[model samples]
Target chain A: MDRSGTMLFADLLGRAKTRIMADWSAELERANARVPGRVSTQELVAQGREVLELLQSAASSGDSDPTSAAYSRLRDLLAEMSRARAFQGFSPTETATFVFSLKKPVFDAFRTEPDLSPDAMSAGLWTATTLIDGLGLFTMEVFQKSREEVIIRQQREISELSTPVVKLWDGVLALPLIGTLDSERTQVVMENLLQSIVDHTAEIAIIDITGVPTVDTLVAQHLLKTVAAARLMGADCIISGIRPQIAQTMVHLGVELNVVSKATLADALALALQRIGRRVVSASPAPAVRASA
Target chain B: MDRIPILKMGHALLVTIQVDMHDQLAMALEEDLTARIAATGARGVLIDISSLEIVDSFIGRMLDSIAAVSRLLDARTVVVGMRPAVAITLVELGLSMPGVNTALNVERGLALIGVSVSGDGEHDAGTEV
Candidate 1:
């Protein structure tokens, strides 16, 4: 009953491969229709044939445990399939269904086996249930892991894309900060701004936070730290783009940004130009601008 | 027993720390800078630390003391050429060193000390005390 159960199931699987595949394909079509991703009939048939072949060999090894070395190749193939389907935006249920759908067809083949003993029949059924269930859970694990990897990669890319230092003028750089300020983001911002100061020999850096949603004590502290770091590198930071609401919130929180700050980027730039001993004067005394219709 | 070379450029004194600093070296530098300020009656002191790659809490405190002592001696001290990594580290360590003035390089440092960087070696107006 122990070893012969899996071997009997393996033998029946090989003998009824064509009939089981036909039933599995029909089950897969019903499951696939509910899923968002597209798996063409030809590709589905090909994958089914491959999985059936691998499963037959693995079951013949008389190891009911899917994690056993005898099932290593089968595990690899399922892991690969789940990873691919995960990237294709398939849900966890859909991926696991690909393995679970094989259960019914394989069990139906057990019923069709002629003159099968009651003991062997029950043992094979138990083996089939455990083996297929283990494989289904495995696909789910692989799917979830791949999804987590994609999320982490996207988080890193977003942080990298958020910080950009622009050279507004010679010796003047501007960092337009959008979104919230976390410690990790502040670290990236400070690094990029400081490097820009050294690279461009910039004397003044304008931190425009107009796009920032709110100003809490933590965010204000991060701003002050960045300012101090810039000052240590011989560049002064001017924080601008203070919305009326953020200004009120800051005042209420008593967040003292000792460094110079202005209401707008233009005002900060003007102050910066003044500090560096530069003046922008109009060349013509005529109208500053003439709108032509 | 190596001493950091201090070159007198007109009314401003230039001290370029080309080697890693130990406790004794830092102490010697602080003493020598004060003595030099008293002896030379220099108006500006520019310490170029661009070559310095590492700093500790002791060094941070030493810089603050140098700036304080030099200020008492009626000399404006501007520490210049701090690397980005050093600045970030200092900030993370909570050592802002507010007493010291910083500049990007020697040229900017000289300008901050009110010394015109002329090739003809012209001594201009000194830093305001």
Candidate 2:
């Protein structure tokens, strides 16, 4: 708080910079923060040195509050580091350890200050603890946000991948849904299926829900809407992959698909082929008769 | 008043909606289609809406009305080329157009009505009734 105390703290940090960085990096390594192979020892040490230098300068600026404008540079550095670590797949503990690992080195430096009395040493250590703790928690918060963003993006991609419309036959299309049909995914399914129908000029679309785990009223409604959209596009829809459980659920829920549904994709495909005047007949065993003769 | 044109293709009447239809234009189209169906004795009516980006509840109701009127006139109605967004929006708007037959395109619409006629030849025999 006083001018001499601030000068002593700055001199202690300046003299202990190399030792603090070495101890901090060793601590991070012990914590397995660098085990993910995302960051190298050299890069980690460089980052630690930059952060320590910034912390030393900010603390010596006569403002001990880490949240003040004096610590803006330090805060920005920590935020950037946490965001990068988050995108690099660092766990929350590993991300926060970047700041938490510095506490011991800083406390050791404060202890080694011979000229400081017990009260001054305690005050300096407390200031370092508060600043490091605040920054560590900040890193965790930024890391969580980044992780959430990654998860949401991956979920969107997975939903898009799940709904694929395949051209099963010349006049038939198949959409094998593989997950729970939420409203968003259903929209994707409908758009992909309808677009394929238009592209192939298919007359019948077989929507196979066998891979779908369950069918609630809402899912059933989405299916019906998809069917209606396909029919509106001039293609009658035949729902395939209606497992017995789903059938019972549909009946129990009184959710009428109002479209023809088959027990299996093969059956649906066969019926679709039949409607298009095509049959998959096996050749008779005339070769066996010739061999017997 | 801009009137939607209804072209007669053999026994079927074709109405391709290329403009963003207002309530008045949609109503006029419905009246004109009914009059054309009566005058031409058409057995099938095809409404192509591929170019129509938006179909509000009013236009949706007009479509239902047109289908119902056509059915009363003993004609099969097929609404074809509905955009995917429009279909989704229509369903979300709670206008499924239950009575209207839908196809993917005009060719399919014609095929649908044609199949219905051939399948129900006896029904076509009493067109006047």
Strongest candidate by DockQ: 1
Candidate 1 lDDT over B4-109, as tens digits, reads 8788988899999989989899999999999999999988899999999999888989998999999998888898999999999999999999899898999999
Question: Model 1: how far is B50 from its true place, Å?
Answer: 0.4
- Runs in model 1 lying further than 4 Å from the true structure: A287-293, B115-129
DockQ of each: 0.50, 0.45
User: Which residue pairs in candidate 2 collide?
Assistant: A233-B103, A233-B104, A234-B103, A234-B104
Docking quality category of candidate 2 according to DockQ thresholds:
acceptable
Error of 1 at A128 (Å): 1.3
Model 1 lDDT tens row, A91-165: 777788889999999889999889998898999998899899999998899999999999999989988998999
Best by TM-score: 1
Name the runs in model 2 displaced over 4 angstroms.
A2-8, A33-43, A65-73, A117-119, A283-293, B119-129
For model 2 chain A, where is the 10-residue window of minimal lDDT?
Answer: A1-10
In candidate 1 the C-alpha lDDT for residue A226 amounts to 95
